[model samples]
Target: MLQETSRDPVGVLVVEDDAVTRKALCLAIESDPGLKLLDAFDSVKPALDFLESSSPDVLMTDLGLPDGSGIDIIHACARRHPATDIMVVTMSSDEANVLACIEAGASGYVLKDAGKLDIARAVLDLRAGGAPMSPAIARMVLAKVRDNKKPAVPQSSPASDTTSLTRREAAILDLIAQGESYGEVAKMLSVSVGTVQTHIKNIYGKLSVHSRGEAVYEAHRRGLLQLGRPPGKRS
Candidate 1:
């Protein structure tokens, strides 16, 4: 479906775990005359490996991956390939991950439900130095921006809940925010995966959030975590 052109097409690298979505994204890139997909991967490791050798023009990745969060990939690309433009194509539209990706250097944010044509155009727009976002994401970002302009609201948490986190729990939360899987964190800390899970569960309770994304958002909001640092420095 590629159209003939004298100029080289923009190179695109896709990282999506869902098979169907990955294929569709690849096809979308291929279908565009101005875009060429350099590679596609379903997990974080291979993508990181590929990035070590090749720098694509655009990186479209999901936030959730089998090995870790896509934010790690974004951080690597942003640091290693500063010229590359980062984009997020994920089912997660939550503010925490979205803002994290933005802070991590993703200039485009689109939902998976955005059709193939839109995906291709988004890549093009991204490469053209435009920030593209799904409508909902765009609106949410605008609202967040507006809210940021307002006076700071005093942060409060229920005293009954385990709101106070231990140093280890905060460390674990930071690692999770850095996209480390439980097993990876366990290996890094020399603990069992079960123990890591228990720590994460306790972190959730203490943060009053159920999921990793929420935990990260809450922790960041409360100044318990510093995100968007160099990969290892994130946690």
Candidate 2:
């Protein structure tokens, strides 16, 4: 068992559309003296509104919400409250959903079939800055990394002079590609959001990409992101 620290009780918000599952989750969270249940919602709209008004220490949400995808909630929390961590507690542990959740900045991913104690422990792990993925999900993430290590198929294209960006610019682009919000990236790097914005602007100027998605795609195409390696390392 992971040892619990003496830090403040982690505040949590549960978002699940299922009545019984949501109730069980709430009960599980509340049962833990180290966790405080802030609110529970069945949809994304109210959850988003609550998040905007009062950010919890952690978010435990389902992937399929009534209003929108749980990725939206992850993105919103990461952007608005960089300090708040996110965990995905859902029934669908499909490869696509697992990858999407990780890319959406979820710190942990557990199946809904997990026992109450297991779920609570996973939440605690997330609060301690640990990414506790279910075993199958872990294998999936590893497989993705391995796949990225394989040699890419070369494509013939017009050789245009490519503008070189600084190391910082490359790092920022990599984080963006990994689905980190500007605020979260800034906090991680111990810089202001404005600084991150400036770096993003410079990155866009150098890469000639306007949107975040476009920039990330261009970075991947140019081998700027080493998908096989760890998050910060260059491939």
Candidate 3:
């Protein structure tokens, strides 16, 4: 496992094909004092090359590129830098594209139409161990999950709900399912970021999930969470 990157001002790598959109996205990330623009590229190969040398704390990429699909870059980042938080900023929301990115380790998916502020905020939330997804993207994922559902779950052994999560862990899991970042959750609960992170780990342990997405999905599968975001979490 890779050691965590120091993310005082979260380091961001952006890959977009369009010159205009690329410039705008980079500028928006730069506009946020809490984020730093590590590098920006308009192609998959160069972005892949950059990842070979330095792993940014966050990667924001468009799905289409001249050389190849952004999904390629996402898979590369997920392999080389598992600690990196990936957000897909794409114009395409096709079911295959959305599912592919998430499977490739993307935790956030925002449409290209989102404003610059939304773009930047998504990076912040992603780096803070949150799954910041567009509402449509969230719906798409949930729809797929529902479609895959069997009429009846195995009455046999599923992960035991009786395992029990602490009240604090339950609260943190709920906020996380609601797409709240650690900083946001800390603020909401009047706790330190460290405190929230600790609870997050405990939640993962109790839920037997290795990632935030898995924790959310497992909780939802167990009826502890309903997999949907409220309004205003576009970032």
TM-score of each: 0.61, 0.64, 0.71
On TM-score, the stronger of 1 and 2 is 2
Per-residue alpha-carbon lDDT of model 2 for 1-235, expressed as tens digits? 1232447788999999999989998988998888999999999999999988998988999989888988899888866776677888888878887766665557678886755446677787666545666777777766665576545544464322345667677776777656566666676666776777788778766666534544555666565665434445531
**Cα shift from native, residue 48, model 1 (Å):** 0.6
Clashing pairs in 3: none
Q: Per-residue lDDT of 1-235 in model 1, one digit per residue for the tens? A: 1212227889999999999989988999999988998999999999999999999999999989999999999988877786687888999998999888877768778887755447787787666435677889888876775575434343665533335677667777767655565555676776776676688778766765534545665666666664344334433
TM-score of 3: 0.71
lDDT of 3 by residue, 85-119 (tens): 88888889899998778767688888876544477
Lowest lDDT 10-residue stretch of candidate 3: 226-235
| Pairs of residues at least 3 apart in sequence or in different chains that clash in candidate 2 | none
Looking at candidate 1, the ten consecutive residues that score lowest on lDDT are 226-235
lDDT of 3 at 34: 88
Which candidate number has the best TM-score? 3
Residue 174 displacement in candidate 3 (angstroms): 5.4
- Candidate 1's displacement at residue 169, Å, is 42
